[model samples]
Each structure stands twice: as structure tokens, then as C-alpha cells.
Target: ESTGRPLVILDLALTRDVDETVRALPGVVHLDLPGVRDAVPDAEVRQVDAARAIIDAEADDFERTLAGRSMDSLITALRSHIGRVVMEEIERLRPLQSRLPASAVPSVDGRADARVVAGGGVIRANGSSGAIAVSVAAPETTSEAAAKVSSEAADEPVITLAQAERALHHLAARLLHQPTVMARRAGQEGREDAYRQALELVLGPDSVGGTHD
Candidate 1:
């Protein structure tokens, strides 16, 4: 079985070069050194080691060349050195899609239908057609949660069932943190009718603010 770790490769010469380049570019971090070395095989490690050795030798020769050079020469050399360092540390990771575990991925069917805004109540998936049935009650503490419960209770209510359903959908969009499938059933125009029917079934005719049974 695969360990699920991504394979990474580091090239010291490339890392140094990237490091220097990044200093000039700004806002970029070179990861060719530790990052890649920690993830790749021994062959790549040997190549990185060789590149570092070459860079050190080149630095010595360049220093000698600057012995009699002017300030401009020194600055140019400094810039090049920084750029080389930045690039040398750049590493890459190769990801294997087939190696990924299925359990690690999310399921598409686990989505909701609509959410109640007041209490974060969400209509159950596939329940929006016949009656507005919720998969779960709205959250008790959330403003939307509270609103949903209160709206259902208040006589001469300011919030209508249709409006509540819309609010639920909006709340779901905001906080349910899941995609909602709109319920489609015969004779149902929107979420309100569905919810009303669900409430009537659950709460009965004597229940306050429920649809007539």
C-alpha cells in the first residue's frame, strides 16, 4: 500500500538559482533545498550535492574576478549570488492521482436541499417536493435558527412560509457549507408549499403556525 506521501525532488543547482531569482522577484520562497530533499530519492540527492559543490567553486572564482572591480561590479555580483541561492532551493512535488484514497474525498450526494436562515435549519435533501421537510432542525443558537422557530410560532406572522423557505435556502447558502438541490415535485411551485406540508404532517392541525392538516 502507498504511504500517501507525495514524491518530491530537489536540485541544489536549481535551488540556488531559484533562490537568487526569487530575491529579485520578491514574495517568492525557494523550496528546492529541504523541502524536496526530504521527499525525493537518493539519485536526486546526489545531483543536488554536486550542484552545491559547483556553486561554491564558482563563487571563489567570481570573488577573485571582483578583486579590482568597482562598486557596480560588487553590486552586480551580490544580486547574482542572491538570485542563485533563491533558485537552488526550488523543488517540485509530483502528485499521483491514482494513489489518492477514496475515503479522503468528499461525497456529492451528502448535499442539502435548502437551509433555514434563522436557526440554520436545513430542509432535508429530496424533501422539498411534498412538504418542506428538513434533514435536520436549524441550529439553535444561530440567528437564522431562532428566526425559523419563531416565525413558525407567531400568529399574523411577519415571515411567511414561502419567505421562510427562501430564508432557509439563503442560510444554507451562507452557512450549511454544502450545495443544495432544489426540490422539484408535482404541484409544488417553491420551498414554502413543501415546508408547509411537512410541518402539517409533523405538528398536526392544532399546532400553532403549521399548515392545515
Candidate 2:
């Protein structure tokens, strides 16, 4: 429910364009101006209260929808929404090509960047700083081979075995966020099944169903 009263200061700003269009209509009240506040009577205060209640209820619904959802899920949802909005804006601005200079258009390269996968127990240099480290363990044999190879690799900064282990932990945390680690935590069959169910609910079926024990 909406009370026709602005529930937030930002709402007032958003209504400015709509208010201009309303003012253009023949018999519409010109409540767009700041002076219009002076005309609000004591009875109109009820409208503000109604609007506040509506806004609060909407906020509650938003909180509930986001509850227990991972940060990644929230980020993905927001990015998807923003991508749609950006596409719409680009389409809207397409007709104004003449007004917008050719130079004003932003340039973009459509190439897909290569993704480097980190396997566990494989030592490699940090891409950003060229610091040596290991990926999370891939397989037992592969991990052992990687550790041995890393140990023999010359001219690399010497990170001790203990330091390398710590780096693996950090790398794991970086690549797999808390929700994934929590879902994989060791437990008996019943508890593990419960965790799997909870994970399916949170991360969706694709994340939980495809993995084999």
C-alpha cells in the first residue's frame, strides 16, 4: 500500500520527473513544489503514518527474502538486476545518437578473459605480486608431485612447508567462501544429509547435487 506521501527523502527526488508530468495535466494538484508542504493539514498527518507503516513492511519482506542467502547469491542477483537496467538505459539512449557525440560513447572489448584454475597442493606464484604459493590440493598424487616440483623450482622465493600449508588455507578461503566450506564440514550421515539439504536450499540444486562423495 502507498499513501501518496513520500516515505523517504530519496523518494521525493525520484518523484520529481513524475511530478513534472503530472503538473502538465490540466486539473492535477501541483504538489511538486516545496511550498505545497505548507498546505498539508493536520488530517493529512495520517497519510504520513500510513506510508511509514507500508515502507516498514516492505523493508521486512526484503530482509526475509535475503535471510540465509549467501553473499555470492546476493551479489549475483544484484549484478543481474544492474545488467538489465544498464541494457535498458543503453537502448533508451540509442535514439539520441545525434545529440551524443561519437567520441562520447565508451569503448569496450568483448573478449573473454582467461580463467586460471587453482588446484590444491600445487604451488605457484601469486598472479598479482609474483609471490610463490600453492593451489588447493587436486589429488593426492598430483598434490605430492606439485609439492616436490615447487620445492625444486629455482629462483623462486623460498616459502617453508609450514608457510605453504598456511597459504593453502588462505587460498581455500579465498576461492571457496564460508557457505561452501560449511556445507562440506565433516559429520555423520544424518548431519551431513541435513547439511546437504540446507546447502541445496541456500546454494540451489546445481551446487549440491552434482558433487560426488
Candidate 3:
């Protein structure tokens, strides 16, 4: 009676019988053993569909999480590689800057930068943000000024901005070449753990996962 518009009563045993007058009530359904057996398959199908939908949703969420982790790991690795390259180059050039005459070293008031944007496009060595952006705050002379100094002061040891850019580019390229290729393959192959492990191994454990923006 409480089953909404139509009350359904299932009697799997034929021992107890339903009253004739009670069965006569409007919007009342009485199903015997045969009728109940006939409904089982349809009910089972509906339940199976619901369970499958839930499983699919959970699987999709898990996959997306793994993908996100892999991407984060890759970015962290790239940034770490870029930062190290920038620092090494800066240190290497510092001695040259100090030894040269003040006029030979042109001062610049900005940090060196590199970035990686969406789509994980080709890695850029320039100190700018793209698919991944890496900026380290170090006040230094511009590469262009250093280049001019090289030409004007031939006797002195000097490095230009172009050289620095190239150096950064080359170093980054070397470090990223294998990782980039493998990372893409990992994503395609659903090997997230392997990719993360590789990145951590190559870039250090600190590069496990990090956010740029």
C-alpha cells in the first residue's frame, strides 16, 4: 500500500495466499513465484548498468589524477634543470665579469627566466615563461652588453648574451631530450609511476612534483 501509485507484493511461496478483496484494490499488483522470477533478469540488468557507470567514473578520475601527477613531475624536472643551468652559467661568468674592466660588463636589472606553458611544447632556453617558466632572481649584466664588450675589448675574456642563451638552450636541450621523449611515451602508455621515477632520478628527488602557476 505504501509503494506509491501502485503497490506491488511479491509472493515467492504459494503457501500463504492473498485475500480476494485485498487483491481487488485499485493500483495494487500481486506477483506470484513465476511473475517474480520473470522480473529478476530485467532488475539485474538495471543494477549492472548502474554499477558499471560507477566503475567507469572512478576509473576516469583515477586516470586523470595520474596524468596530472605525471605532468607536474615533468614540469618540476624541467624547472630544476633550467635553474641549475642558469646558476652554473652565472657562476661561470661571474669570474669573467669581475676580472674585466667595469666598462666591459654592462649591468642589467632583471632575473634570468625560462618557462613551459600548456601542451608541453618545445622547451625554450630563453629566460621567459612558456609551457614551463623558470625565473631566478639574480641581478646581472645583459648578454648583449657583454657581447659588445667582447668586440670592443678584444684583449679581455668576455661572454655575450647570445652565448648565454645558446648555452642555456643547449644544456636544457641535453637534459630534457630523453626525459621529454620518455615522458610523452609514458603518458601514452599510462606509465605514470615510471615517468615520475625517471624524472626524479634525473632531476633529483625534489623534482617529484611542483606547481609553476
Candidate 4:
């Protein structure tokens, strides 16, 4: 009574074992052998169906989560690949900056930083450190740039950057499509080990985010 929990009594004896007054008590349930036996099958069927539904839902959620993680890891690896390519290309261009035609190079006050403005953003490559920095334009700046682009000729650097970004994005999607498909198939087939092994072989052992559960 203090705990406010219901009390359940199962009387299996052939004769009356519990006092008749017990059934009248608050929060008390008294079940005789015949009553208990008769309710078992229907109660069990209901419970089993509920349990199966929950398990199926959980399994579907787990598969989706796993597939999302696989895609995320692949995207991370792709970004790293793009960064490496950018760094290498920037380094290669460092020596040829002076020899490059004036029409090819964007005007800058200093040779130490090369900046490209495209699609309402700026990408800067540091000549000395070989580091890259990217920044998105503010809303006002983007609007002004858009107005300027409409009124005047679009900058060559902007066009080039947009083209490069589009090409890279397309290539990355194509490159990663197969791996993503394989990951989904592996998760559905319960062959997660094969997914990890194939990714390790392709992206290297250190590339696949973290250990699996």
C-alpha cells in the first residue's frame, strides 16, 4: 500500500487457497487457475506481435543510421582528397605565378596570398604556409556582388572557381556512388565486416572514421 504498487495473486490450488475478501482490496488482483490459463494465449499473442513490431522498427532504424554513417565517412574522405589536390595545385602554381599572363591571374596587392572570389564566397591560398582559408560572403555583400555581376562583366576568377567546384563535386559524387551502394547492401545483408574491409582496402585502414559497435 505504501509503495502504491498493484498486488497480483495467482491461485493454482484445486480448492480455495486465498480468502474471498482479498479480491475486494484496492490495487489487488486475484486470479484463479482457470481464469489465468484461459487468458494466456491471447495475452501472449498480443505481446509477441508488439515485440516483433518494435524489433522490426529498431532494425530499420539501425540500418539507416549505419548507412548515414558510411556516407558521412565517405564524404569526409572526399573532402580530404579535394584539400590535398588544392594544396598540390597551389604549390605547383607558386613558381609559375610571375610567368603567368596578367589575364590569367587575379589582381592582388601581395603575392603572398592568392584569392579567388566565387559564388558569394572567397577562397584564399597562402603562398608561404601552403594553407587555404575559405569564407562565405555576408548577405549584403552577396547581394551587392550579384548586382555588380548583373551590371558589369563577371570576373574571370569567379567563373573559373565556379567551374572547378562544379567539376569536383560531380567527380566526387560519381566516385563515391558505388561505395555508398555497397554500404547499404552490406548493412541489409548483415555483412558489415565486408563493408569495412572493402572501404579499408579503398580508403586505407586509417580512413574509416572509428571502430564499429
Q: Per model, how many backbone clashes are there? A: 43, 7, 14, 0
What tens-digit string does per-residue lDDT give for candidate 2 at 41-143?
8679789989999999999766644443323343343334444544564444234332323332222223111111122233445445646533554444434
lDDT per residue for candidate 4 within 13-132, as digits (tens), equals: 988799889999999899997776678898797998999999999998987777556555544654566556656654543443333334433444433344544344445555567455
The candidate 3 region of ten consecutive residues with least summed lDDT is: 114-123
**Each model's lDDT:** 0.38, 0.44, 0.55, 0.59
Between candidates 2 and 4, the one scoring higher on TM-score is 4
User: How well does candidate 4 match the true structure, expressed as C-alpha RMSD?
Assistant: 13.5
Q: Tens digit of lDDT per residue, candidate 3, span 61-146? A: 78866665556556655767577767776565445444445564444334333221111111223333313333433343445444
Q: What ordering of candidates by TM-score runs from best to worst?
A: 4, 3, 2, 1
Q: Estimated TM-score per prediction?
A: 0.17, 0.27, 0.36, 0.38
Backbone clashes in candidate 1 total 43
Off by over 4 Å in 2: 1-47, 58-122, 126-154, 178-213
TM-score between model 3 and native: 0.36
- lDDT agreement of model 1 with the native: 0.38
Model 4 lDDT, residue 199, Cα: 73
Top-TM-score structure, candidate number: 4
